[model samples]
Target chain A: MRSASIAECGHEESNAVKETQLLDIHDLVVHFLREEQVVKAVDGVDLRVKPGESVGLVGESGSGKTVLSRSIARLMANAVIDKMSGQVVFQNTDLLSLSERELERRRRKSFLSMVFQDPLGYLNPTKRVGRQVAEALPPELSRRSRRHRVAELFTQVGLPGDKASLRLYPHEFSGGMRQRVLIAMALASRPRLLIADEPTTALDVTVQVQVLNTLERLHREQDMALLVITHDLALVAELCDRVYVMYAGQIVESGDVETVLSSPHHPYTQGLIASMPGQRRRMNKVDGLVGSVPNLALLPSGCRFRSRCPHAFDRCEEMPPLMPTSTGSTSRCWLSEPEAEGEDPS
Target chain B: MSTRPDQSATAEGVSIAGAPPPLAAKEVSVVYRTRGDFGRRTARHALNRTSIEVNYGELVALVGESGSGKSTLSKVLLDLASPSAGEVAYHGKALNTLTRTEMRAYRNEVQVVFQDPAASLNPRQRIWKCLASVLELRGVRSQLELNEEITKLLTGVGLNPAESFARRFPHELSGGQQQRVAIARALAMKPRIVIADEPLSALDVSVQAQVLDLMIDHQKRTNAGYLLVTHDLNVVRAVADRVVVMYLGSVVEMGDAEQIFERPQHPYTRALLSSRLSIDASKRRIRDRPILTGDVPSTTAIPSGCAYHPRCPIAVERCSIDAPEPRVTGDGSSVACHLAE
Candidate 1:
């Protein structure tokens, strides 16, 4: 059923859906064992998603945003998992500590749900759209009951409810509709957390807006916490409340979305916002800073962004820990810290 | 026809291209015949009686969404795709009517830079080899001559020292650098007209700015006319001298860039600009929801009169039964709309 107008639903009721802490992650690290060395894809990142608050993980490609989000869902295979260490607390149990069989048993219900970038990749080509969503139903449901639930979900995500339409393959649906099918499947489980990584990136601008609106409305009605991963800062400005800016496998800045986007303290965050097309044009023709993300296998010595930072100094040679600024937001930059008195560069 | 009051008004609407020679396309149309889902052959008009002109050193923007036929027009102008009808005339010579030898001679005067740099280059070829091939095709033989031109071309596009980048391959370069190489390749021929097709869409937001600035500066320095094709209005506002707004393969509005932005007469143009989500957070909160009801219709099955009528928020009966002729609005914008008339 359609929820009441979003404005009518008081913030208290919206926040009161079991007041669940969906995923409590700390010191999450994913490393790959190369022939010569270990490369940390995700390093020392901590994240927490409450019941109904959606958090956006904003970063460019190769910023480790995708890898970190994927790892939480246990989508990465054991063979591909080189050396992972972290406490992934889910549903009152530390998921990282659970045995394979036990975690698999618990994963379907209370752990998490995910919508990947390529909707076709997540959806089976040969399988009927209804069957894909129905498979997420618990084994306790009989065949008829499962089919009935799938039809309800199809209508929930704004798809036609006709059984014949549901029987068609994934190719029959448009890109936006395929994404809706993926969302329907994710919501079928009614999991506490939903991780959508670049869900609307592939669609056109107007379609992207429509899909994002659907996602936001669903988050409110379902009371599901969301993790929206995307490279588009403009999208995050519209949808997200809090944001974490990642760079070189580290959280460079994290704060209220307005604070981070409007007046970002970190240099990388500033560059990212300034780099947006409609953001203030650069005073100089330098066009903000330009440098490729360093190869993950061969990271920089310290303060990974220092190589391209305009404010880099001698102190940046040492790795600056992720610390709070005067604004109370976390930023990992030497310049963000108030220097000791009488330590003058001039 | 010349003495009529309407003809005098139409003459008043034409803007002058301040230059030695005027570059223009006359009744340019591109039609493709394709089989329908049921195997019925149908004629698809990708571009419909479109005409565009750029002064000797003007930068004109062709703005349209996908299937609006902007790229098809670009390809036709670049001599890559032959139009079913009409002609592209530069300095009074029709491109379609030119002999093979004449076309080859004209190719050097009009070069195109494609959107994706990765797809534009031959992956196996070294950067130097690619640059050398352009010079070779133009009948330049000496190594010293090739080197001098290659260095100048690279440096012109902001690839400094030239030698460092000349030895690299397309894969070895970054996205911005690859685009620079593409620009360099286009400039190696010293073309008078540069047609860049959605050049920044594939790039990151910041890199897009840098590359667009580079192209703009190049245009200013070389005094070459630019025929830029893109769906982005923000880019058009920043770079275009005159903007031509297209909807469903027809020019719905055309005017000075700032004029169009300030007061768009066509509903399509108004909706396109207002639909974009502004980057400024305050503006995002303040602006009302866009009034665009649905997606652009497929080009294959265009509406009877105005292709945009079905989705037009303020469409009138005349817009559905009869196509509105291009008329000059009071604000100096040319619009094809019954309401505007």
Candidate 2:
């Protein structure tokens, strides 16, 4: 076990250029084995989260956004990994290649952590909040010191001083407080990258705003790399620096938040953005698109979105690679490609 | 059976008694019995003298978070759950004395589209069978006639090629499709009133919009009254013509949707609207809005005077001592706040 905390080592990785991409993933694939065949949950995904940036991985319920983030977090107990061939280069170390031990040793403590959706269920019910946070600290720390640090960690995450409140069981606290404790646990290691998977979904709207504001403050102060996985576009538009619209386990579009949200390049992205109630105010009710994501086990032959695509054509029969479109944004749509001879269905 | 609108007949038949105007509920309250390890108490005071009325062909939204009694009031209207106090009338008829057959007829007139489409639909049955089961119970004769009506209903809800969709099972379809099927099934009965309880809350954001639009469009075509129950203020803003704000089983505020949005008289209504994610960056700051203190009080232990006084930001001494009666605000909005007056 590594005795030293990365913060104590004074690693300069935190000082990496803000403009430079902190993590870049290309052609990332994650497959699950069923009885009959392999389910390609994340077939080919390209994702990039820059330093001091918050990016959103958005899709419907079964969309591969969760799987992709879990793969990076290395928390894929359910994933029957047929392959995860992709570059998840962070601080020049390929996360995919690192062994369990190397990954643990090189774990970007204080640099990478995750706050899951279910705050109450995430922490062990029987465990005290202080002890749960203490588990994230270095094992070398004595019981007394760990206890002291736990109180400080709780305070840092907006818990009250002395944390006599945290000394109570997990069930004792309210949902919002439990979520704050989860954030406290995530920050205990001082991770540079934070992968929050729908952290505020279960919370009330008032608490959701409170937690979101806290995240925004953390992202600004620590310059942390944040990848928010959520189904809410409104939340993404509010918080994320850039947005990646995922469909059928693959990123269909990725760009600046304003550009993508305002003028989406891909049809899927456009439908999703427009389908939101704020965007559709009785002019023409397209109801977004009419279909769900295709089954991963028996995915469509060509562009996965073609089945639901309003602009799908004959050319969509062949897979459309992620290409820089004429609209000055990246989109994996045959329609976006200028020279493509696909007939316009519209 | 007349297709044309008989305005006088419709008005006379649907209008509320005493008021001689439209349907009215005067102080409807519902209390449930609950027994815990400690002792016997109230399980939930689901509805607290929540007086609301939907005029003929008008869409009204009863909006509140869980335990606020939106669902309870919905049940009260359906007479599935009877109110402990106050009265619910249809036109001039009191509902509690209705025979089973009369209640069934009332149900045929008023239908509900639940929030969970999957749970509402029979998973074991095909989509057509689900619709067929209802039609069969209603005794609609002729297979060809029934089939035509089903297809028309499906098409009306934006499901093209109803035949193909009808053949599929509930699980085979998407969430949006399942909801469309549910809506079609509801319309198959040709109900005069539709009480949609959080219909779009379970759906994806984009899909929710589509469902809302469909519901709104159908209401326009049919001119049926809607009792929309939802926790989302945004949805109410988009679709509802009138808004009813419920708090701790009480109708805290009620008004035209625009009036409620522009000047929310009730503290609960104000908090809900303010808590909504505002696109305006300056208003997005959390502290600018007054956060409601404490969780909703247990229905059994509802406050002595005003149910909301415990959590109301501007609760006065009178607010805690005596419950404020609903009064028409100067702004033409009905508010049940002591401070509002």
Candidate 3:
């Protein structure tokens, strides 16, 4: 039914629904336990990414978007997490149920790969960048073939494939070049799904555009599903066909990028769209949402965003379930309730 | 307000008409000598002969990508870093010519807010101390008076129940709150000029609007000139009265915000404007946008002639041979592009 609804949204490629979902997350909740309190990082998020589809998870710093992505990639340490209950189904197999050895095997097979924000921190300072990428390549092949594969990956990511450039250390390359090398490393495995977390946030705008172009082209040619996790709505609008707006550790709204950005129902989503600076011609003052993200440890009852939401009212005191709105998208807000639609809740 | 010395009017009195701009960089150039490969010393021209000024009641946005020398230029204007070949004038008087007392007064008049609030603030001190020290330096001494002033400062920045926020350490607050505290510290001096370098870059998008609003609100109330050095054009479009576009250590374009946004002449400015990803989903896709290819060349090896000619879309033989001088167009916008009509 979800796939059918997505198909009805008039995506360019109808075949997206026919293919099995590359990744489907159900009721994912990740919480960290401190000395006494539990940090409710991700509280019940349901996300889906169809094969060859680019999905974006948009949220601010404390919105649990990063935690959700880390949980999806199974990068979280078991000891640190106090409560984690979710079904992370990847290509028909539940990733949560897999043993460490089995997961390692799957990771080696390149079923999933992730590129992080800080490229310099991820790359080895002493080792040549090309060798680092070559190491991520399958060890079964001879070193000569591995080097050839590394060069091919470099070319794919719009980086220089020459031997001289490959021999340089991480410090020698620019920030954008270093990020491309990391992307090349992630691409070395030829994974079906690529999870890029704030990939271009560290680089300059011009460099950022270059890196984004490379990612867009790679996504097109490789036919890989992309899950871009970022705070930038503009980036999501540019890259993803579908988007999920997360707020205070929960998905507030989910729909096609066009519908969600254009006619958002959730108050948090509305505030986010309005808060974006560059949308209007000449705005004297941006009507940014008041207050900050609620403290996860001591969250207020009912709607997580009520304190900051301008349109929040009595109905928001109770937690609103994620329900389908008239716009064919799901929104977790009382304003989108069928009977309450088209009326000013405030 | 009347008790404090009027530094702008008193300093030098060299102005023919009214007082000069609060802070101005007149053809300032900064070069750094660094150890290169094999222990060789190389001179990196971080800022070319760039000129910009912040008036008493306007926000001037200095925008550029990384390595464009926007940060270096901001430092030069703030008098944190001295220019190698040019002068930074504070109220019509050159900084070099200022007396000891005059220099101290200049420091009080011009306050700065850095990108990372956490780094700028003292982690060991409570929020109130961070603000109180600056106030005490300005001659607010009594404990009761200090508390009153700190409360007013904290409330002004939107931290409610200012007493609680003042007691907490910097680490206890979020990035946004810390930034607000940083803004409060800068405001404590009642500065005539504020130099904020990438103040919103470290903040979350939602929090950025609130902080920007606070800064603009304070600027209007105090009539303080602001030199906002940032890479985000959208923020520039929203708050800046005037815009200064920098590219490869040079001011590629300078004009009214509306003129720069609506009808940019420089190719670099055009590219920068177009390259910005719009939140409007109906806008053109990344593939369709005219994205400038290649990273900014290392400042150490800046290309000869027009620094932007190699990446510029419409470069001719003359552009590569001779650098184009800045020319004011009929619209009153200054552009340094050779092909700009």
Candidate 4:
């Protein structure tokens, strides 16, 4: 559905990408109707991805990272999307402003593509791997060229791309190989931006490392912008240049990975880092964050995270904006009032 | 059926190690019966001569990737399934040799908390009934006594405002809350040993940490030996006293957690450690030593010699023809790889 009119847009569409930024999302608000209750999945999210930039969207479950990313391409399938009001500008054009047919063309011809957590679900078990990957190619390509292009894409993503290898079914491939197939399929269109949502979470540790390496290679060689949405801060720390920490549907903090990871400004960010299990020399006895994520339907007013914040005070009766911190980071907490520079909190 | 309890029923008095391990597997091997194409039954060796012990007061982690037979070993110990070729014992009594009454007591003394809490908990039952039923099976008759015990069990796992949670059904609770209920039910047995299989994997990071801490607290208070079965090395580092690394249905390395983690000797163990995502960003490296290639072999057709030979980075000619025997090194570490020597 998102590819039909891309071919019809003709010659002028070839030079349409005049924007400096690869993708820009402004004040995005996405709400879902669940059992008659409004679920503010994403509220007033602002983010940008420049060409060749690698950014990490760090959040736990229910932080709306997935919804926020999906909304960029209007890719929410079979969901009760009640209210979606936002501008997803891609390459000098507002994608939201395009007509239904134009939006479909814009999405298919525009700057973004997505890779999901589950590889098995996306790939058809009964179909040949080569045919499955070729489905993502443009309709203008010859049948033989599509098959040949798929094999090339498979090799690009580090899959065994021999003729015989491409003929095997999805079931014959290992979990890591299945993910590689998905990556190859995702790369077929060669979009400027690739949104990978927990692409390595289900894989084994060894397999995860392999996939991360593949993603890094693509980011550097392909010159493609990457918006990696995941809960694994370690991967973000390793791969991404910039990081955004989200909590309860809003981005609470955003900064360079080192600055954000090393000295997190928001309490939620600190708690998330503390929650992750590292290689302990001795058995660690530290206390983790006290409670679970609040229900999206019954989310507290004022500050969404106030109920869980340890430093939450009376001032938290009102929402906090994404204000600048002294360490060149952005934080959404009243307590993070840009303490004096050169003062090491660690 | 009336029976006199053993003098060892006073589990609280057994302070620490040196006694016989509460749960022990002696050269246990398990073969599963599966039907292949053409209705031909095939026997697959899930566990082969795997010997493990869960000592009192120490948390031992059984770490392995998928298809490494870690789950098979856990099931064998739990007696949820029988081993095709070895013996599983509970407090020195072989599982097959135990009398019906003794076996029932053994079942209560060794409880297991599974990966999925929702599945472990009965969906039709209320939280209160779940705990109450466990207590009732242990011979708690009075309604008042049952309620008090249930509240304590729930509170022990930090499911507070116990009254509210007690009345709520399983579906009403979140994943974390449901897991807490599962842990509460498991704790109701007052087990001498707890086998938690990937308990924290399903949860979010914040919830995972809290649940891990709760399990640690329970282990300390009860001094029960814990067998934490998981693929996450970080979880093992956080709580486990000892570590056992498995690959392709065999123990590749077993030692003190510090020794295994700080200086892993076996190639398989080293690869596992290097593959882990460390929190320290400065040393965040992708291409490290011992980065193994290839996935684990199929259970039905395991590699002839050392199952790891195909993927081992430093495999020698000997590795392909002869499997290494378990060798005990100084400092109490055990490894079953020729290269480690």
Candidate 5:
């Protein structure tokens, strides 16, 4: 387990291992020009999601989680993404290599799909939900068959499956039901993988529970890989089998949710977990990280989190790799490096 | 209703019983009349016979789902919108019939910090300009006095080196900084009651903690009561002394924060506690707590009877026919569930 890393598992033992890769994002970099500054939103990130797997990307607002998700979906044409380098391999083909027309064709054929945070905006207000859900399906299907399929999808997502529901407008549905409608549309394409970005952030606790249950049920029944992007680590623990903790546009930690969350190795991850209120009986005064996320364009020379990290040392002047910890989680910190210091100051 | 600045009760609950509560909404009900898609008009019951009071130096959290009338109650407290049925009182005086001058004083006494600081702060105005506009009410004559007061306010909210932040526009500041400025503006009036409507929900996780600390510290420093309207239970647990849970515009449960969290009586309160997904080890074992099903009924067509009985797992047939009145429970909490006892 000492050499167990994403890079090692992806490259060194790739040929022998038969864990079907649904989507492999290697060295993904997303840079945007904001006010003449080239903000490196996502810098050299490597992530993988296999078939029937559920992975989470948890980060704060400026951590570039949204940008990374949009970058993978190739939906950032208008976002002014100056440079998007790296490979977004889906199933067998590199999505970055495909032309606009080819990408559109592939996307239409339903290799993958996405559900955004705002269902009110994603759903058409004037049109009936049944038509919108049916419209997401390939046009080759007969109109009657599409309606039947939409109803089935609606049932799968736990919406009322009656014909009356098909006639309802987007404005008539509740926020949670509208989100379920969007999910129904996302599943209409029958994609092999689904990316939901902050799907429940706008909802209440009870509604969030309903939506999460829907996503979990979908992941279990359909077997489509789930990539959930959110700032809520608690939601991540509930839905994801594995998780990636992102900070300042970098994957600081990644591992199974059961092990990584219970004992997060990275300082940033530890601070994030502690900051959550109501998790403990007493409000642990050991308040979370001291400072906010660093500016992307003006990032520090060493680790981006060094400025806010509590246990910084001289060795932290150099960036640490995402190495495996003894706890089976890959952490991007010098403290987690077993051979770095003999005394184990941490 | 006993935890005021001067008066104290049994010490077990935050009952503001004898304290002519600094800010309170008594039997407040707001029904907005809007024309529907057809020729017919409809009524939306945003708040229905809801009463919430905040003592001079207390932190009362109004916790509920989206359409649970939390925002409407905040508005009633802030005097932003007048309730149709009942009255809001401040300092033992009914607010609905107050004179213009008295209302102006009330406005200054009760300030608000909104959810989106960016939207609340004027984008075209600099931080100093925004702060100065609020200070003008105090009649600060000299430029030096104005500058000194503005800087002091900024520093009070933890934005140090205030001169630099003063010159910057709202867009130039970060979300957390903008929120700090908003809090500073609310604090500038030397407000007695600050109605913070989901102040930390827009902030990032780390920044959320810092902002929460600032708000709590502000409450401690000024003895200014806070009516915190938020859905985040974590925020409630961290700072709120009393917790009020609303369901479809009605107060289903209200009690001390510890009693509400540890031993929730109402089925809705219990469901809300279980629905929370925290970073605690106990969260995983919450599978036994039944997750209430069904969407929250719309405010326009609030359910009859218990309002929660449609989704309440323990609801009996009697629940749907008769509305349950709030009653005192053993935990020193007031629960509206007929089966709570």
Candidate 6:
């Protein structure tokens, strides 16, 4: 079955080889203005997603992965942004250059849609769940058709699409059901690219598996590109084809999911893999990185992870560029540099 | 429930061999009664006859999903909520039988670390003041001694250059730092038993590992019994000496962590283990594991017989009519399933 899926993926990729990337991001920088300090949430970063490909963006809380994703959807609040630069190209169009009205129109046109972590916060508590999903549909549809489309979308997301269930309020649903409702709303736009940010973090393990299965099925059946942003390595391994590891507002590593997870080159990536509780047996101490994430406003001059990195040296005083490794993966660490005068640590 | 002598002996060897455990809940149940429409009375069985014991120097993990009665069980064990049936005991002494002075000592010996540090810690108080209040209750009154103890606590939790951290309020510190302070506060009393409820769920994975290491290191140093209540199975597999699996107000399985992970007997245990997403690429494809069909049934209207029958993949007609009593297997693990041998 796995080999068959791989063959299918290869066939799909070849068919879309001549097409432009589904989404392309270049040197994107976003800084949040906090009183006297500028929090460099997302420093210079580049990422891309091919058509119908699933990409995973992995990071910790303050690693700027969220900021990077929000910037792509033009979801960041303009009031707090001190500086924003770089181009977010979606479907050969510079989304960054588009006005608010145009972006709204584009969003309504099913170009792209995003699902956030908190399901309850996005849904209207007072409005019927069915009507909320219907609102995401195009305004041209008749009321009867909109209701039918909402039910179909609900069924697609594995939720009860019956009239009785549709009339229920947001509070009446479980956490997993509520998340499925949000996913139904995202799918209502019939978007080509779906961006789900920590979609299953708030759910239980069993419920998470159910939701993941739904997502995988939808992605395969609809031929939609998916960008999953989460802190879970296991989630990435299970759902994404390729992954980009973000740390301190930079892409520390990017490669095929199997390759990066199995044999990571960046020290930060290695640390993350090592810290997973599943890697060790009962009572064995996990070798977690020493310090907390750096303060964004007062980030270290050189490598931001140097403070917590065990192998930090004088060379680390200068930031290392994201360089290609022997395994066809990119890593931003001096240790992975081709000409470095030392044995490869990974 | 007939007990075979050899099996009972093995069970006694694994647990309850010598002195009494630090904390134990014996057949505890909690039922919340509320008035419904038309002045009708309704009783929700939040916890149903659950028994758990945490021995000194051991880590016991209570694993379950939301509304599975894990939190209700924790509340009962902490003596914060009185059990509708059964009892909570400390060192074999029932909580209700203890004198006022003994109860005060019991309160001092049991410390709790909550899930969210921001909500748990006093926002208005500085870090030192939080630890100081706990110390003051322990009868350390002098200014110089309090400061020294505060510094020591901060250093113990890896907040080095402790003096600087001691002056900051809870809001000033990061999530990890605030959690460290909370851990420091919990450890200040030098309690024999610590109850941490979803302690690492709020933080990132890296910070989670750090906080878990701190907890494990402290448990080793102090030989304190730890009852860790959480939903993450991976964390439980890493540190728990014993595991208790709860579903819809009842414990379906309880056994040694290794045995439970490697050879889970109960169907619910098997499903939960299979559902866990591992960081192995070879297992990437969604294989045909026994994925449960639906959500956990409501506690207010629990299933007639086996609470899990509705979602159990291999459930039989008997499962819907008769609730299986917990039976000990040859491996000394207890499973509440008729099919478990």
Best by DockQ: 3
Q: DockQ for each candidate?
A: 0.27, 0.41, 0.74, 0.56, 0.50, 0.57
How well is each residue in B1-341 modelled by candidate 3, as lDDT tens digits? Answer: 33333546455443455766667788889999998989898989899889888888889999998889999999998888999998987776788888777788888989999999999999999998999999998999999999999999999999989999999999999999999999999999999899999999999898999999899998989888999999998889888999999988999999999999999999999989988998886778776777787778888988888999889888898888888889999999999988999
Error of 2 at B268 (Å): 2.4
Per residue, candidate 4 scores C-alpha lDDT tens digits across A117-193 of 99999999989999988888887899889888998999898888899999999888899989999999889889788
The docking category that best describes candidate 1 is acceptable
Local error of candidate 5 at residue A178 (angstroms): 1.2
Stretches of model 2 off by over 4 angstroms after superposition: A1-19, A104-110, A161-164, A280-287, A325-328, A334-346, B1-25, B35-42, B278-313, B316-318
Query: Which is the winner by TM-score between candidate 2 and candidate 3?
Result: 3
| Interface RMSD (Å), every candidate | 3.3, 3.2, 1.0, 1.8, 2.2, 1.5
- What is the Å distance of residue A193 in model 3 from its true position? 1.2
Which CAPRI tier for candidate 2?
A: acceptable
Highest TM-score, which number? 3
What residue pairs are clashing in model 6? Answer: none
Candidate that beats the other on DockQ, 2 or 3, i.e. the better one = 3
TM-score of each: 0.87, 0.87, 0.93, 0.93, 0.91, 0.93
* Residue-level error in angstroms, candidate 4, position A247: 1.1
lDDT at residue A308 of model 4 (Cα atoms):
83
lDDT of 1 by residue, A1-346 (tens): 1134333444676443323455778899998776767777899888777657878898877788998988887666777668899887765567778888887887666437888788988889989888888888777889888888888888877788789978989987777789989998888888767899999877655556667777887887787788899887777777777889998898999988888877677888888776654344313233555665677778988899989787778888888888787676778987676553224433
Indicate the residue-level lDDT of A109 in model 2: 57
- Each candidate's lDDT (Cα)? 0.77, 0.77, 0.88, 0.84, 0.85, 0.88
Q: What is the full ranking by lDDT, best candidate first?
A: 3, 6, 5, 4, 1, 2
Q: Per-residue lDDT for A259-295 in model 2, tens only?
A: 7777677899888876766434434344677666677
Tens-place lDDT per residue, model 6, A119-172, is 999999999999899999999999999999999999999998899999999988
The TM-score measured for candidate 1 stands at 0.87
User: How does model 4 score by TM-score?
Assistant: 0.93
User: Which residue pairs does candidate 3 place in steric collision?
Assistant: none
Q: Superposing every Cα of model 4 onto the true structure, what RMSD results?
A: 5.3
Q: Point to the candidate with the largest lDDT.
A: 3
After TM-score superposition, what is the CA distance of residue B329 in candidate 5 from its true location, in Å? Answer: 2.2
List candidate 3 segments past 4 Å from native.
Answer: A1-19, A344-346, B1-19
